[model samples]
Target: MELVFKTEDAISKLLTIKIEYFDSLQIYLLNDLWVHEMEGDFFLKEVESFKPILKRQLKYGLNPEEYINKVCKRIKEKLEFLEEHKVGSIEFLQFYCKQIKPITEITTFPSLGTDFYDEFKTSLKECKTDETDLYKFLVRFAEGNFNYTKYHEFSIGCLSYVIWNYYCALTELYRFVSTLQENAPFVDFSNLDIEDNKKCTEHLKTDIKVHFNQDKISVAHLFLFLLKEKHIVFDCKDERNNELQLKRFIEAHLTYLNINGDRVPIRSFNREFSEARASTKVQKHKQFINKFIYGLEQYRDSLKD
Candidate 1:
């Protein structure tokens, strides 16, 4: 009984399980409207409670009313509007489905095709440390060549953003890593016990009081090490490598190659992102969308990509 206070409440963890339900609902709502033909109480039963619980779950920081307005009210109004204008026919159903298309409808980033993502993952799987200058710097830094310290802060900052949207990725990855129990056959954790073993691993900054072991794939360095094997330049260069630049480069070579035209928000191409003359109006629109998709990329690039 004494060890009980040291643990998170069982009900909190149970509530955490509800996050998957809310996450799927949010993703479904992203490209779809509440234009479904269903029982009248669907909103009350399926969605109304989700807002309150999810808001609490996320510890929502801004626009406290956003979930209520965009999700709860948006669906409520849509259902009412649709009910008043309800029409029944083959074309109407098709149109309804079309209007509420899922992002998965494309099956992949449009220009990138379905296989590019798979290929990219394969590339990542094949990556190794010897291929990266940063890895070499890390190695020598470990070996007592202190010059690596000169680039320490700069490198960590660059590495942080290299995997674009990693903060969100970590949320998803946490689900996987948390399920990894002690002494898993594949998990070679010599130093996994360092610190609390429950906090984020830092690459630098001694004050953080947490770090990852070599076997920690969750560490950004190992991920970057894998990325390096494919010659994908994610190293945060002094002023040359921005997220958009790397994104465009990857899209061009991996996604848009042999496709004969750039695409939008999902798939795009440009061997070089900064070359201002090489884009169409759609490309320009997508540039805006991509900037919006990961605005941090643009802001950071502006600062010193």
Candidate 2:
């Protein structure tokens, strides 16, 4: 996927916007804690160290409840702006980063970590300027050091360091949201019968057997004949041609067996079908055509008997 930001300035501005969002959220959480009277000395000390003004009870004579309300309003406005501009949420940013191949290297680093920097540098060089600029902006937003030399070489080691931290923050954000609510509603399977479930599954797996000679007439030839004769009509509403629909249906079902009692693999079936379909000799073969007709005649005769 193309990088979202086109220009370097746009990338920089996006990073600034994200940083402001993170800062706002942090402040909101601190005020929330203060309002609930849950702020301890250690918490206050940490808050002061991180951003001194948040220790409003001691350092600043601000009402925690008011701060929380104000922060909530500001967050709502920011969300509206994000919606309007299609700036995307943190999840979208993570997904976009994942789509970029080089960025994925940041997450799957080797255990040794020695060759990681060299690999990252090589990958970064091959990346588009917009991708690198966005990455560099994210690093800066995450409080990562991004030092570049006169020769346009970036600090690969620093890039790796900051990117790992940024990735971790994204992970923690997901974990935080996951903790807030259940992903799916609880279901009690206590009344279910295990034996019946097993029987149902086994019934579904039962294969449909058909008559044909694997050596004389390949599975693909038989499949094409059946489809052409309307013996295996696809129960689909798609506008795709019969060949494509049959291929997809066979692949999905995987329950058909050739006359030799061997499962028909989709890959081999496709190859055989392509070759057979393209050959006029195969289509016009008298013996081959007769074999299928003979089988159908025998089946019909047996039914009448």
Candidate 3:
């Protein structure tokens, strides 16, 4: 619905917002601010023409969390630099923040998710919006606008936008986060920089790549019923098949890694594999493929010695 560009720093009071929402939303905002400041046209156009690329990312890419994380890191670096350098002046920064306001004028109903996403695929066939050109306005608004509320609404649309591409990217379902560590890295808790969030989102996409590269559960369509949807399911026959396949694959891969003393590669793969592994359901077989690739690399390294 809008795109508001603003900033606040240590010298300047940071804009405060209540956090009961998703952390990614905040990260996205900060990154957006950064991207607009730096890449300007490219960034704006990205939001304007998001469908194709986002769709590609969702289909043949990495995990979303990982992508976002990298972006978060990069954006933080840039913000820190900007805060330290103050390319212009404190008055300018504060002025920038003061100048922009949220745009909430364009009101519209929610979009249909099912036709595009697996979970919602069968639930709704089409998304009906008002005939007042809300979608077109959104594209134009995202491309060049200075309204916070509009950006906020625009961001909500972004979530749906990202989800649609996600559906198009793969046949099955998956998750990028599970059993998060007690001390994970800190990310932008404010929705300040749109670019940072975009980069972070893009970086997190790799998890999907790791999945597809590994290829066991090759199912093409999956639906998520809850927030943490790791697409895995098994029947009586599947249990036996899984046990045998897993046993053979594990033995071969792990043996190669251990014997070759490729602990680094093996351990990394182990972590990735565990992260992707589902207790009750199945996902892409790419997990194992990644492990095998590591194993092979390690084996080749050992051969050199």
Q: What TM-score fits each model?
A: 0.16, 0.27, 0.19
Clash count, one per candidate: 0, 0, 62
Please tell me which predicted candidate would have the highest TM-score against the true structure.
2
Per-residue lDDT tens digits for candidate 3, residues 1-305, read 01111111310122121111122332122222321122213323433343333233323444534644443343334333332332122222333454334433323323322222332212222433322222423342333332224334444334323322222121011121111110123332132223343343322332211122222221111111111242443224554333323322332233222323333111112212332444533434344445556988999988954
Give the alpha-carbon lDDT of every model: 0.29, 0.35, 0.29
Better of 2 and 3 by lDDT: 2
Segments in model 2 whose C-alpha atoms lie over 4 Å from true places: 1-217, 235-241, 255-264, 283-286, 303-305
The best candidate in terms of lDDT? 2
Any runs in candidate 1 off by more than 4 Å, and if so which? 1-44, 55-60, 87-305
Candidate 3 deviant stretches above 4 angstroms: 1-107, 113-305
TM-score for candidate 2, residues paired by index: 0.27
**RMSD (CA, angstroms), candidate 1:** 25.1
